[model samples]
Target chain A: MYKIAVDVMSGEKKAEELIKGALKALAEEKELELTLIGEYDIISQELAKTDFDSNRLKIEKADQIITMDESPVKALRKKKNSTVNVGAKLLRKKEVEAFISPGNTGSVMAAGLLKVGRVKGVLRPPIAIQFPAINGSTLILDNGANTNCSPENLEQFALMGQLYAEKVMKIDNPRIALLNIGEEKTKGNKLTKASYELLNNNPKIKNFIGNVEGRDIFSEKVDIIVTDGFVGNIVLKTTEGAASFFLELIKDSFKTNLLSKLAAFILKPYLKKSLDKIDYRQYGGAPLLGVKGLVVISHGSSDSTAIYNAIKAAKKSIEENMVELIKSEFAKNEELE
Target chain B: MYKIAVDVMSGEKKAEELIKGALKALAEEKELELTLIGEYDIISQELAKTDFDSNRLKIEKADQIITMDESPVKALRKKKNSTVNVGAKLLRKKEVEAFISPGNTGSVMAAGLLKVGRVKGVLRPPIAIQFPAINGSTLILDNGANTNCSPENLEQFALMGQLYAEKVMKIDNPRIALLNIGEEKTKGNKLTKASYELLNNNPKIKNFIGNVEGRDIFSEKVDIIVTDGFVGNIVLKTTEGAASFFLELIKDSFKTNLLSKLAAFILKPYLKKSLDKIDYRQYGGAPLLGVKGLVVISHGSSDSTAIYNAIKAAKKSIEENMVELIKSEFAKNEELE
Candidate 1:
């Protein structure tokens, strides 16, 4: 069974919501087992409400919860029995193959580093998230993990991102691109311009497309886009803001008069289907790549459906032996160097 | 009369399209006069198709045109008599109070710098564009003007952007914000972290809201968002990409079924009305702030409506003495320092 630990008390949703979702995943994936990390009473109470297979499920006791607003390092230092810390401990003790959290993003990363640790030869564990693209989805990495990144870090992200796309997303010889201001080799700021040369020179990267602008991020041209966490984070948030703003504007328009209201009512179901294609929950969660153990971070506001999908994602990661492949690949590169 | 020089020979659209738009602006604004810079024959031939007041329009001979793809510095050297150069010269010679172009962006900035020059204390002339925000619009600066920016440069941009928002946009005590990954003061990359301190310490800035994340950019929280050209450029293009991508997805859904298609036909006009709020043409063009003369840079894919709006923007910049206000603001700041 693929064992994954879940941080049930740290996200925006309550313990019951997360446990409910974990139970759903446990039911769907017969080969999957989960260790719910939270207050034992809360987990047990929530578990009683749902019909779940007890053989594949276990609950770990935790007294504290790391809040979304708390500082990661400070919270981890103080809240020793926090659900996030407990989940990380479970991974560290080899009790679980992977750990998933929808808690404080920083706390999750900090705990992953302090507890499960980094992959051998990895500089930074960049967050890799799938952005909804015109051609299925494009994987964008370093999504707010490392705000300031070296050219080497970006190249590393590209390397790891390419592997994830090929292994997990099931794309063959994925096209990797450096996200920049322009498509030209010399177009970006200091980091991207230098990183372009690194990606170009690296033989390990089989299909390194030179550069792609922000507009090309969602296009069918490239499979994986590599950027620093700062740029990548901004891109993610800006997209969210723009998409919702447009939808809100459209909704407001539908309320203008009777004719438009009728049209909106008729078109609601159809529009929802189209909009669902861009939904984030379908993609599950962002994988914190370059870590020694598999760590996926879900959005803080993730619903039950999102959490359920995240557990499925963890199962796939474990099944594919993602961490081992990445570890071995980095080691091989080091030997070559 | 407000004299504005127009570069009618460049951009994606034909010279006739630009001339027709300029003529429309001329007809609407009685006090506005234009000096069209282009190939004399092409300008005259295009002008023949449109009925324009002869007294308000004058043609300047330019034997060359600057294509969008040409390098700014190289093209300026080779094509000295290019419409862009001629228009810049017109502004430099004080024959026109403003210059508007939809040609190569770099060439426009180069021409402005080489001919019209910068305001004495200005470090760089940042491109200030009005982004469609939840509450009307938010002015964003350094939209791909300076690729690598120092903290001081960002501070100057915020200052200039604030001035432009107040003087040109007529926003009262505009709320200025530094765009970063997070909302906290310490939650930013090196440049923004330092810029936050600078903006906070500067007593001259009336209302400096610390930092805003990318998601909050389009919201009604702040009036002006200050970012380096690299990030700003990405934000602008990403917004364009996401907006169009969503619209395209919605359009595709409309064709999925005959019933949906009928509903789409009914909703089309209402949706168009709401979407029109986001049309780039309505905001005229991005003003190259901190320059000695007013230089408005329109989108390359501009239509006649866009051109007409750009001319109106140029007229307003002239009427408001935007250049002088910025010049004096910088001069005062420099003196205080």
Candidate 2:
């Protein structure tokens, strides 16, 4: 069984929802082992409420909880036994194959970098999230791990994102592209322009398809999109906001009158299914790439379904042995430059 | 009558849709006079095809056309008689109150800076676009005018954005907020963090809220959002992409089966009305803020409706004397700083 350490004490709901979600994942996936790192009393109470496989589920016992409001790096440094840090410890000890957190993004990133550590030859670890597009989900990396980055960092992200898409996403020969304001190699800010040259010339990114604009992102124009954390974070947030805004408009329009309400009732199933496809919850969370150990960061407001999906994603990553592949890729990187 | 110079040769359709849209606007608003700048033959022929007030619409002969693919500044400098340059010349000479362009963005920005000249105390002029939020439309400034910006530039954007939102958008005492990764005062990249401090401490921006996240932008969180042009542009494009993607999903779901198709037919009118509100064309183009004169920049793909709305937006800006207000605000900048 693949061992996974989950920071149940992270997120807004504390251990209550996360524990239940982990229990649900255990029930669904029998070949999984979960080390729920949180307050033992809370975990036991929650575990007692749900019937989970005692053989696969266990507790790591973390007392300290990292609040979202605290400074991420500072909190992680001070609260060594915080659920995120504890989970990282388990992963570092080789007791768990993957570590998952739904707490403050900065804290999770700090834990991944400071506690879990970076992969060999990795400049900066990036968060690669699946963006739901017209054809299928397109992966975007450097999704808020580092606000500022070098062109080399972006080039590295391109290679990492492509590999993740190929291995975890299971896309055959993923097309990699740089995110920019315009499609031209000469287009965009200094960072993108410089990164464009590196990404264009680099043999590591085989299917580099030049620069792509924001509109093309959701059109299945490319399989892997590489950008700095700054742009990537904005894109992710904007997508969520816009989707929520549009969905709200559709909901309001249908509920405005009795006739439209009845029509909405008839189309409810179709609309729900369609909306669910774009929901970030369905895709779980983004994985922090270029980390030594597998790390999945779920959305702060992830419910049971999101948590369950996140666990499944962890299992997939472990099965693929993505960390080992990443190590192998970086081992030969010294000769490329 | 307020005289306006319309770049009739500005988009892909040449003078066909632009002339018709200009004619329609002239017919609707009798107090407007349009100096259509393009090839004399094309303008007169397209003009003759429609019934318009001869007194309201006139043509300025221009032999050059700047293709979208051409280098913006290079084309603008070489093609002196291009529609954008000719219109800028008219505005500079006080022959027209406003210059509207749907051509290359960089070329228009260059023309506005070099040809028309900047407002005396303005550091950098930004492009402000209306983002349709749940409560109402929120104004976002610095939408791709300048990629690299200082904190002072964002401060100026806040005041200019507030003025535009107040006068043109008719929102009194608009709440101006700095766009950042998080709502906290210190949570962002160097540019955003520095800009946040400036925006928070400045007195010119009366109703200043602290930093707001990307998700809060489309909600009724604030009246005006200010950021560097690069982030602003990405947010604008991402919002457009996500909305289009979600709307397409909704449309596809309704047509997936015969039962849902019937339901869609029943709810067609409501859906169309709801979608139109989020449509950027309905609100018109963004104003190139901090310019010496009124400059409305529309999307490259702006059709008849978009052109008509842009004309309306230009007229509104002129009536509000937004340029004069921006000049006055910057005059007192030293004392405020």
Candidate 3:
């Protein structure tokens, strides 16, 4: 069984919603062993509501709660029993194969970096955000946090992203595309321009598809899309905002009048299917790539469905031995250099 | 009558389709005189196909054409008789109140800056692209070109975007917001962090709504949204790409099977109505704001509807005396500085 630690005190609902999701994950995957790190009473009470097997579940007692809005690094230092820090420690100690959180993202990353440590020379870790494509989805790196990034950081992002796609996403030779304003090699800002050259020259990164524009992110033709953390975050947020705004607009439009309401009623399932194709809940959370252990961070507002899928992602990442693959990839490249 | 120069030999179809759009514009607005700039024969031939009033129209002959793929600066220097350059000259010469091009964006900006010149002390000219919002629409600035920018550029963007929104978009004291990854003041990279401070400190900018995330761009609460050109362009292209991809996917989904086809047929009009809310054609082309003379650049794939709307926009900009307003706004700010 693959062991994964769940931070049950993170996100909006604290232990209640998170434990409910973890129980669902535990019930769904028999080959999964999960330790819910939070207040034992709150977690066990929430678990009492579900008819899940206790054999696959364990609740680690904790006295304090780290709210979502607390300062990340400070909270990590101060709150020893906080789910984010505790879970990171569990992963660091090899008590768990993976660490999953629906909490303050920066805190998790800080905990992962400070407690769990990096994979030796992993310069900067990137969050590989999954955006729905026409067929499957595109893995965009350096998505959340890491506001400023250099060309070398982007080069590492490409390397880490490509290996993750190859090993975890299980694609045969993923097509790595650099995000830019235009497809031409000379089309981006100073960072993208320099990174493009680095990406092309790196023999380890196969199928470097030069540069791709914003619209090409969901084109399904590309697999791993790489960009600086700043641009990547903007693109990620803008895409999310557009999707939500449109969904709300469509929902509002359907409520205008009786005929429109009837039409909306008929089109509900199909429209939902269409919207669900781009749904974040289905895709689960973003994987913080380049960490020593598997760390998947979900949106703070993630529900049971999101939590369930994140766990599934963790199981898959462990099964694929993604961390070992990344370590070897970097170690081999270091030798070549 | 407001005079506007139309680059007839620009974009995909050259004169034929462009003249068709111009003729439609002429038909819609009677207080407009249009100069079709291209080879005389081509313009007259396209005009002859329509029953346009010869008295309100004039054909200015130009020998060369700048295809979309040509290098922007080089094309501006070599092709003197090109429609983009000639049309810009007409505006510079005060022969036309405005210039509209549905061709290469860089070429138009090149001609506008090098030929027609920028407004006095106008630091960076931003392209204001309209996006549909919950209520009306939002004007987003620095949407195309200008790959690298500083906080000062973004500050200029907010000032210019606010003034343009006030005088032209006609929303009194438009709400100006800075685009960032997170809404917090300290949430962006160095550029945005500095820009946020500059925006808050600028006294000329009224209704400064602080930092807004990517998703908030479409919210009706915002009037004018500002960002560095690079991030703005990525957001713009990503939004466009998402719209196109979703539309295509919906179309493909509707045609999947007989049941879906029937459902699609039943919900066809409603779907189009919902999708049409986000359509770019209704709003017309983006105005290259902060230039001396009004210049509007449309998408290359713009049909007659888009062309018609762009011409309409040009007429509106001239009527608003947009250049004079921008000149005074800058003059006022210079005194404050």
What are the chain B TM-scores of all models? 0.98, 0.96, 0.96
Question: Interface root mean square deviation of every model, in Å?
Answer: 0.8, 1.1, 2.1
Per-model TM against the reference: 0.98, 0.95, 0.96
Question: Stretches of candidate 1 above 4 Å error?
Answer: none
lDDT tens per residue, model 3, B1-337: 9999888777776568778888998988999999988899877777776697888999988878888888888998998889898999899999998888887888988888888888887877888888888777888889865777888888888887886777677888789998887777888888889889988998877788988888787787798888877888899989988777777766665665666677666666666687687989888888888888998888887877788888987888888888898898888878877
Give each model's whole-structure lDDT: 0.90, 0.86, 0.83
Which candidate model has the greater TM-score, 1 or 2?
Answer: 1
If ranked by TM-score, best first, what sequence of candidates would result?
1, 3, 2
lDDT by residue for model 3 (A1-337), tens: 9999887777775567667777888888889999988878888788887788888888877666667678789998898888888888889889998998888988887887788877866788899888899888999998965778888888888888887788778888999988888777888788888999999998878899888889998887799888877888888878877777777766665666676677556666666677677888888688887778988888888877788888988899899998998898788767877
Output the number of the TM-score-best candidate.
Answer: 1
Candidate 1 docks with a DockQ of: 0.86
Backbone clashes in model 3, listed as residue pairs: none
Q: Residue B310 of model 3: what lDDT?
A: 87
| Candidate 1: residue B91 lDDT (0-100) | 89
- CAPRI classification of candidate 1: high
Among these predictions, the greatest lDDT belongs to 1
**Steric overlap count per candidate:** 0, 0, 0
TM-score of 1: 0.98
